[model samples]
Target: MLQFINPLLHKVIQSISPCVLCGIDRQQHHSLCRDCWQQLPWSKSMVQRQEIDIQVACHYDYPIDRIIQKFKYEQHLHFQNLLAGALLQLRLPKIQAIVPMPISNERLVERGYNQSLVLAKMMAKALNIPIWQPITRLQQHSQKGLSRLERIDNIEQQFQINSTSKLRYRRVLILDDVVTTGSSIYALKQKLEELGCQKIYAACVASAEI
Candidate 1:
């Protein structure tokens, strides 16, 4: 197992752990060298789960952006594990299910992949939470340069429940790679509540001001 071998392998990684973001030598556990970690813009506090709960580790900027770009767009799949480990450090509450933000059919067709799904899988593995695919994108629209109010309006009718199967009893955690306006999670949370989910949490790797 990787965990069983990690202690011994750490010395090896220390010798060879090149920074995925900056190319510096790293002696750390997950990924990204020490210099890069220090330079990352971390979130200052843990956000509460109201109708929805949001937990994020960092701000979406600088080195975090470059790393996400590499992982999501450049096909660096290994970075997902690194991100999952980083998120684990946040000490989130016990969760029943991990639900990733669903990508629209149009976007999936254009990009040939779903980055949030990948991140959710990684998080699920790290957190030992079952992934529940219970949300579907109901529509698609361009979201470039949209204000917070505009984003809320655009997402109001954008999502729907995938099923009525045990949704009423599940304590779900919504997973995403990033959160800018929190509109998408809010919309999805509203829909989940309508379906009778008692507790909903939103977990993302980073957040940004938009």
Candidate 2:
């Protein structure tokens, strides 16, 4: 009952609320005004990293970068709708579930939430698909000053399969807030493949130059 009412109530609230970005115009596109939404640094294309092609909605620049930073580190969760909206613009593949990038327990404790999961929930609700998390991330460490190969190795060690789950999906999409090296996505993909996911696709709200 709440699930059915929540979306309708949200739409009503959004209809009266001002744009989250500009705070001038009424909310139009995913809580942003039309101009603000149109002004986003849209890429709506694929970027290659770690030999994986990731669909991205915008370039990590200007407001998008700032928005992500705040959303991830500063608890500006209200920006999630806008960020999720960015991802929705992509030409996504047909998938049965959405796999939000997992965060380490340490990061989750420090941040109070996994930012990727927050975005994924919105995406799942919008797309009417279930969220799947068959992999768990171990403690994460800084990759600064590391070589590309070292960074990949470090990230690959963090993901481990959650053996407790018997459920499996063949076609799934991995969702993340940003993609830079794509090492993390690649690592997650490898783990998902081991879990019998035949078709794995990845998408992000933004892609940064690496």
Q: State TM-scores per candidate.
A: 0.81, 0.95
User: Per-residue lDDT tens digits of candidate 2, residues 1-210?
Assistant: 988999799999999999988899999899999999999999999999888889999999999999999999999999999999889888889999999999999999999999999999999998999999999999999999999999999999999999998999999999999999899999999999999999999999999998
After superposition, which runs of candidate 2 have C-alpha atoms over 4 Å from their true positions? 1-8
Whole-structure CA lDDT of model 1: 0.75
- What is the per-residue lDDT of model 1 for residues 99-133, given as tens digits with 9 covering 90 to 100? 78888898788666788888778777777777787
Best by lDDT: 2
Best by TM-score: 2
Can you list the residue pairs that collide in candidate 1?
49-53, 53-202
In candidate 1, stretches whose alpha carbon ends up further than 4 angstroms from where it belongs are: 1-15, 47-53, 144-150, 164-169
* Count of clashes, each model: 2, 0
